[model samples]
Target: MVIKLTQPPKEPKELGVEEFPRLGIIGGSGLYDPGIFENAVEVQIHTPYGLPSDNVIIGRVSGRVVAFLPRHGRGHKYPPHKIPYRANIYALYTLGVRSIIAVSAVGSLRPDYAPGDFVVPDQFVDMTKSREYTFYDGPRTCHISIGLEPFTQEIRKVLVEVASRYNRTHDGGCYICIEGPRFSTKAESRIWREVFGCDIIGMTLVPEINLARELGMCYGLIALVTDYDVLVPHQPVTAEAVEKMMTEKIDIIKRVIAEAVPRIPAEIPKCGDVLKYACV
Candidate 1:
């Protein structure tokens, strides 16, 4: 296990940690946390790397405490490839956070996974480059059997089943993880439609998945569809328009997350410790 046995800084504020949450949520794009967590406090961490994306917010929602981090930073400063994937995960892990649930805004690649839909990705096809995806590196026993199924099946089932009972509009889809802050061109979106048959596409979720996989963390994604890719010709989509839509949907997403957050059982899954086998 790549455990950092040292104690963190004396004061979390010193490390710039704003909060220490039990559950971790990596919010993407314009979707800031709802401050739904009552009695929330900010905590800091001193990772081997520099600071995390933003200050960590820790508090309770529906009686379940969760840690919320703006994956792209609060102002969406970091691009898709530039996110400090390892530092974010390591910081969360350091905070005694055992599981992660990421919520991202994605473009629909399939006609069925349209705008205003919610998808719990069952599979990930990564095309991400220019990013570091794991902690296991160099000549050390830097290997773990990270299968393609990086997502926790049980957790995903929880999301899918809960969404099914809560909102009938939600659906499941395959997420195509690409490398970019740039939206895919018409031709690229078409390739997803014709060749790969992915239901949705997004800039992030690549290194995020792999890092979680190697770390033995139970991970799942709840992708909120903000727009159809260039494949759909309703209007010329830009970052500005996507931001507007995301801002509008913040409450809707929070409502969904708040409903789902309480359902996470107290029992921790085994995925987070799978590294023990390969590490030794």
Candidate 2:
């Protein structure tokens, strides 16, 4: 249908409490559209950090309302290092979003985690530099503990269950996030795989995950493996190849999201209380 792009309400209450969506999806790489949202409308939200990557698309998926944001903006204008992580998470929080499913195109760091596979990362290593990593950087001084579990187990379970029906889905993995507008060198790729034991490699997912936690939001990642990150001999990852693979497998990602959105538990008891012991 014709999805209308409109200005956001001054406050989320202006849209009525019931209209506020609890679920948010951050679309990465080639996954701009979920292709399952019905009656979608785009709303531009402004936050203290800055404007989000793009307008948040609010719609119904599997009869539940969801907010979708293109992580890199519409034309992929922002590189991984340049993404406004704090703004994006804050914008979603302002919309009453309490849970987020971030979709990303990642390279396989291991041979078994081949291209075209789906991985729900349970752990992550941040190797990124020069990005705002937290919300409580001032008088508040919140030390949000992400040591326990960074990605929400509730959401990851749902994503894994749904994705496994369509493809080779790995229930859990360790993702290594690197600062990049560029691909990893062979030496670096080897270190991540052989030395660090990273299952997947990507540019995003560092500050984004950390920021989501600071807001007391449940965050999960559905990583689509698009290439072997130079760890596998004779197969060096390239932008064109990654893009092409993502395009080919985008349908499966859409289906997994469409199915998983409604299955996520409506009330995650401890999720909202994340900030209780975090403030200094």
Q: lDDT per model, in order? A: 0.74, 0.86
lDDT tens digits, residue span 1-280, model 1 = 1122234544434333454445678888876556677767666655776677876777777877787888988777898888888888887777756678888888887677667677888887888878887686756665666555667776787777766554434545678988887888898888887898788889889887777767667787888777888867876568877787777767777787788787775546577567767764
Q: For candidate 1, what is the TM-score? A: 0.87
Candidate 2 is scored at a TM of 0.94
Q: What residue runs in model 1 are displaced by over 4 Å at the alpha carbon?
A: 1-20, 146-148, 165-170
Q: Least accurate stretch of 10 residues (summed lDDT) in model 2?
A: 1-10
**Tens digits of per-residue lDDT for model 2 on 1-280?**
2222234455544543347898999999997767788877777766788888987888889999889999999888899999999989988887878999999999998889999999999999999989999877787788888877888999998998899999999999999999998889988988988889889999999999998888889999999999998877788788998999989988888888889999987778677788899887
Least accurate 10 contiguous residues by lDDT in model 1? 1-10
Best by lDDT: 2
Error of 2 at 67 (Å): 0.4
Alpha carbon RMSD to native, model 1: 4.4
